[model samples]
Target chain A: MTDTLIVPTFDEPATEAAGRKLVIICSKGNLDMAYPGLILGAAALGEGIETHLFFTFWGLDMITTSRMENLKFTMLGNTAMHLTQAPKMPIPALMGSIPGMTGVATKMMRKQIADLEIPTVPEMLEQITQMGGHLWACRMSFDMMKLNEADLYEEVEAVISASDFMEISEGAQIIFI
Target chain B: MPTTMIAGRPIDVNDEGFLSSYDQWDEKLGAELAKLIGIDMTEAHWAPIRFLRSDYPARGETATLRRASTVGGFAIKDLFELFPGKPAKKMAYIAGLPKPKGCV
Candidate 1:
């Protein structure tokens, strides 16, 4: 499992063709945080690269059937998030804490994503799984959240431990998002 | 872009071997390109390839998997089996279209 092919360039020759592998550690559940891992994993799979997404910590919410579609985008503690009209000014953390602010932020983000015709979270999971990307739920997170297999997205492969992830991630490029 | 024979005549393709000129694509050349990538070019394979060919003109870019499934009416699961390892790139390559630009 430790043996993996050297990364191939864009113009990979047929004889030396060895499929690459990628593992993404999805550790956050925010709507903004969810996209980075899903996007990268799907991009890798599109290129014929083997891709695995491991959802741990709050990231387990990304795969939770009830939570995935409801992920919120709160600007609190996100220093980089700002309104388009005032890009120079970072929205105050206190402003992000106002009641119903998470809903507004999430709605705005969804509209922007939709304008570009991007798929929603559920759609992304479906497409990724269909394209042969592996989805895994961390056992520790699953237990912490008191979640069951039925509560998670159907595409999730299994609830596994950290050591199990290391085993499968051998020789694969790892991305923590 | 480099000029090279696909089916028989010369067509422009990029460094990664995607067809640069969208109009140069036809079924014969599509079959030939599929052969280069180890695909046998069945009707199932043609579904997505044909979709990409028709889709690229207005979109000006290759269609992503979701678009292929949604707009082209092709199932994502079937696409995986038909094109194997790299459906999006493989489909676009055979369709004589540029690489897909959509992240989703």
Candidate 2:
């Protein structure tokens, strides 16, 4: 059926109280970039908003079964990471390039998130899905990666074309991360 | 902590008029609620309502519209037509559950 059939057009007060819709695009796969989309999606879901997360390009990895649980943070070429970790003192790029620096940073960041009681990526994604948020994978990226649906988390509702996403996301507030 | 008398029985509800206790829900109460919300309980309506009633206690969460449509075996448009304006909220109420968390 057409979307118009489901879109509420009633004048009742209850109709006016309907929740808003949010569409988030996760284009980055880095551990740091992944949180924004997941966090915002969770927050939106918590607020009664219908939330959709579209993962594309590198972001597709964030939803992949193989990579999602093992996502890592890298300090190399990432000045923002140093700034966040030590606002006043910057770690030199050479230091970040050291072997195992990325692992160290990833561990530290994971610990911080845990200590803060923030849900880890898997937890966040699962909660979002449980709360009824929609997760979509980009069709183009899925093909480019030679990935199949089984490669991604079961929470992903579908692998959709951008045009289809646009159609589904009509009137939604879109955010790109 | 608000209560409303429906069909001569006093029932507790939240601020949004959802039944405070799942145990208090029955087909009679559901029909009463549907009437109060200007809906006529149909087979279509009962599908989601029954699904929610069973799923909530098992899963401890309300199903989203998509889930209801997909797993509950109803079209999204059918749900909208059944409840008219707010299918999710209406389904929860009719099912005698609290307003599904995260629903506006």
- Choose the strongest candidate by DockQ: 1
lDDT of 2 by residue, A1-177 (tens): 111111112334322246478899999989989999987776565445678999999999899999998888888777664456468896787888889988998998899887755667887787677666799999999999999899999989899998999897998889999
| Residue A5 of model 1, lDDT score | 20
DockQ of each: 0.36, 0.07
TM-score of 1: 0.89
Model 2 in CAPRI terms: which quality?
A: incorrect
Candidate 2 wrong stretches, greater than 4 Å = A1-19, A83-87, B1-104
Mark the 10 consecutive residues where model 2 chain B has the least summed lDDT: B95-104
Clashing residue pairs in candidate 2 are A48-B102
Number of clashes recorded per candidate: 0, 1
Q: Put down candidate 1 lDDT per residue, B1-104, tens digits, no spaces.
A: 45676555777777656777877878998898877777797777877887788878887888988899999999988887787766777787778887787887
Model 1, span A1-177: residue lDDT tens:
112221113435221147467899999999999999988888877777888999999999999999999998888888888788888976678988999998999999999988999889998888888888899999998998889899999889899998999898998889998
Those runs of model 1 whose alpha carbons end farther than 4 Å from true positions after fitting are A1-19
